[model samples]
Target: MLPYACAWIAKSKGFGKPRREGGFDNHDPRAWLSRLTDWQARANAAQANSFEALPFFIGAVIIAHQLAAQQAVLDILALLFVTLRVIYIAMYVAGLPTVRSAIWALALLVNVGILFLGWR
Candidate 1:
């Protein structure tokens, strides 16, 4: 959802313009996104990273569930992960690399915690 939102925001700017006139090329969305500059480009990169992060997050949740980890704790960690990712995306689009990387690291740790939640 976040990724799509970022893409939409990026593409939205070009809405109503013909693709030949430098409008977003829905026919070649990836190519169009790759050509983006500034915050829009950062947003696209963030979208890619968000997608890259999803599998690990999903796996951690599934693992914790399979191990019967406490739902309350798992839920909190998952929520924190989501919150951090949102911050990360904002930071990315804002060109705050240091802050974004820190948030990314924190989110990764949260995912690790989730993975270990049921490791009694």
Candidate 2:
């Protein structure tokens, strides 16, 4: 949800029209977004990553519930996942690829851990 919102914001922020054109041009908004540089591009990338990560996270939670994993552990891990994702977004926007990658790796690990717990 947040990722989709970010994508919308990124599109809105990157929107523009050629000065010689009429009221609105027929150019694709995504094409405009793709041309964005710097932080805006990074925000767009982050939005993409957010969507990519959602499925694994959701699957992990559902599997954990189905396997009857401890509620407390699931709760804590879910919180940690959200926290790490928020930080990951910040790192992405700030142009800290190393830190952002580390956070992304951590989030993936958390998801894998949840799945493993469920399997056990």
Candidate 3:
């Protein structure tokens, strides 16, 4: 959702691909947050990679919990993970560095929670 939103923002801001070119424009928050500089490109790329990881991270947590024979907690953890990730992405786009960091920490906690919660 964050990645898609960023792409939309990029297109809306005219930072994304020109209709003539096959390449896309950068609609990511990093693109704008980079002060319209080259770093914007790097940031966009990094965000893209991170977004890709999100699903796998959630999936892995679910699988781990399931393998531990804890289906109920896995369901709860999946919801929490998605919720945290949404907040994290919102913080990133809003340029709230501390809040974003906190959100990330929360996400890590959720991952750990899935493991620990399943153990009991």
Candidate 4:
């Protein structure tokens, strides 16, 4: 998905404007990377980066469980995390801050739900 986003951006920016054909042009990877980094910054500021907090949340759930874990709970939380992440990223990147913040909250709540359900 990142590659696709980068490729789309490159194409839009006319990385290979004259050719307009195949083969990815190496037009300053850092530039593209910087754009993504900037997006990350925006996302972070907008609270649309809740997905970035999932790993630690999941880790906490795992540790809280310790043993006798339930796969169903994990699966549900994982699905929620991924779904909310995709939505959050799309909305945040598209400059919809309000919607993005709502999505971000939803995703964070999902993580909290996971902790509550999984830890129990």
Could you give candidate 1's per-residue lDDT for residues 45-115 as a string of tens digits?
A: 88889899999999999999999999999999999999999999999999999999999999999999999
lDDT of 3 by residue, 1-120 (tens): 656665554344444456345234344534444444343343354367458757767667766766684677677886888788777766666667798789888887887766566554
Shift of residue 109 alpha carbon in model 4, Å: 0.9
Error of 1 at 73 (Å): 0.5
lDDT, candidate 3, at 38: 40
Kindly give the stretch of ten consecutive residues in candidate 3 with the minimal lDDT sum.
37-46
**Candidate 4 versus the native: TM-score?**
0.57
For model 1, state the Cα shift of residue 15 in Å: 1.7
lDDT for 79 in candidate 1 is 98
What C-alpha lDDT values do all the predictions have? 0.92, 0.80, 0.62, 0.58
Cα lDDT, model 4, residue 4: 45
Q: Can you write out model 2's per-residue Cα lDDT over 1-120, one digit (the tens) per residue? A: 759765765555434645244212235656666677788788889899899999999999999999999989999998899889988998998999999999999988988888777666
TM-score for each prediction? 0.95, 0.83, 0.60, 0.57
lDDT of 4: 0.58
**In terms of TM-score, which candidate is strongest?**
1
Q: Taking the tens digit of each residue's C-alpha lDDT, what string does model 4 give over 1-120? A: 432442354344434445334223356644543444444435433342343464667675785476545878767776877687778767766778899789878878877766666444
TM-score of 1: 0.95
Instruction: Please give the lDDT score at residue 11 for candidate 4.
Output: 42
- Looking at candidate 2, the ten consecutive residues that score lowest on lDDT are 17-26
Clash count per candidate = 0, 0, 4, 0
* TM-score of model 3 (CA atoms): 0.60
Q: Give the deviation of candidate 2 from the true structure as CA RMSD.
A: 3.0
Clashing pairs in 2: none
